[model samples]
Target: MGNFFFVRDYCSISVLPGASLTIGNNVFFNNYSSINCLDNILIGDNSIFGEGVKLYDHNHKYGFNPEFSIDKTDFKTSPIVIGKNCWIGSNTVILKGVNIGDNCVIGAGCVIHKSIPPNTIIKNGQNLIFESLQK
Candidate 1:
């Protein structure tokens, strides 16, 4: 938690040992959002996150074995950075190794697995589309 950051009720933020989670100033996280940080998660200032948003910086890694079990799999982690003045809609899931630039808007129910450029708008539908904003 950073300066002037506000997290609403029922939000769960977990920072494991040897992991880092940083939320910048004036960031608002709505209800029922969960953040699971296993590597690094940095949220810039003046960002607004809607309800039921999920952010995970790590995933299970199963080796190339035919009989791979979940309990035997290790975790692979990467960093996630959300830039300033961004708006994330409700029920969105942001995965690892994602860097979202400033002034971006992610639509509701988006499953973001790639980096987003600045001044872009992401619309959620059958397919996610990136639309650039002019000025």
Candidate 2:
């Protein structure tokens, strides 16, 4: 965690053993936000996570096997990176191996599983749309 990092009401963060979570300066998490990091997660300076934003650096690993059962400790993990000045909107879910660049805006209720470049605006989460950030 960096200087001036703050989490508002009900924000939760979990870092598993041997995992790395690095939060930069002036980062903020709003109400009901959560981060489950099993591998690595980095939040750059001046980033803000909106209400109910959820970030995960790992996903449950599963395969179709007759004798296989759900294993709570089995997971596939990667790093999640949010660059500086980014605003992740309410109810957004950022999955593993996602790298969001600087000055980006992700709209509400979006599920992000891919990398986003700098100066981008993501909107209309139900289907999803993208625009270059103006100015």
Candidate 3:
């Protein structure tokens, strides 16, 4: 644990034997958030993650092949990077290969599966919208 890093109770951080989870200084994670790191999950400094947020760096390979059963299917791994001073709202799910830039705000219940630019704000409802904070 680094300086000023705080993870609330009941938060689950599962890192595979060969994988890495690098969390920077002053990173705060709320309760009940689950981080499943199979490859790498780099969370930058001063980032705040809300409750029930889920971060996953790998996903089951569910391609068209029916030969392998669901449990036998391999996991496709990727890295997830959240930049400095970002705010991830509650119940948000960040998927594999996502690179979120600095000072970004992710609204509640957002399922992020793509990269976001710097100083961006993402709000999710019936639809998701991206607003740039940079002029």
Model 2, 1-135: lDDT tens digits are 899999999988999899999999999999999999999999999999999999999888876687766667899999999999999999999999999999999998899999999999998636447888997
Tally clashing residue pairs in candidate 1.
Answer: 0
Q: In model 1, which residue pairs have backbone atoms overlapping below 3 Å?
A: none
Q: On residues 1-135, what C-alpha lDDT tens digit does candidate 1 reach at each position?
A: 778989999999999999999899999999999999989999999999999999999998765467855644468899999999999999999999999999999999999999999999998878557998986
Q: Which candidate gets the maximum TM-score versus the true structure?
A: 2
Report, for every candidate in turn, its global Cα lDDT versus the true structure. 0.94, 0.94, 0.93
| Whole-model alpha-carbon lDDT for candidate 1 | 0.94
Worst 10 residues of 2 by lDDT: 123-132
Better of 2 and 3 by lDDT: 2
- What are the C-alpha RMSDs, in order, of all predicted structures? 7.6, 7.4, 7.7
What lDDT would candidate 2 get against the real structure?
Answer: 0.94
Ranking by TM-score: 2, 1, 3
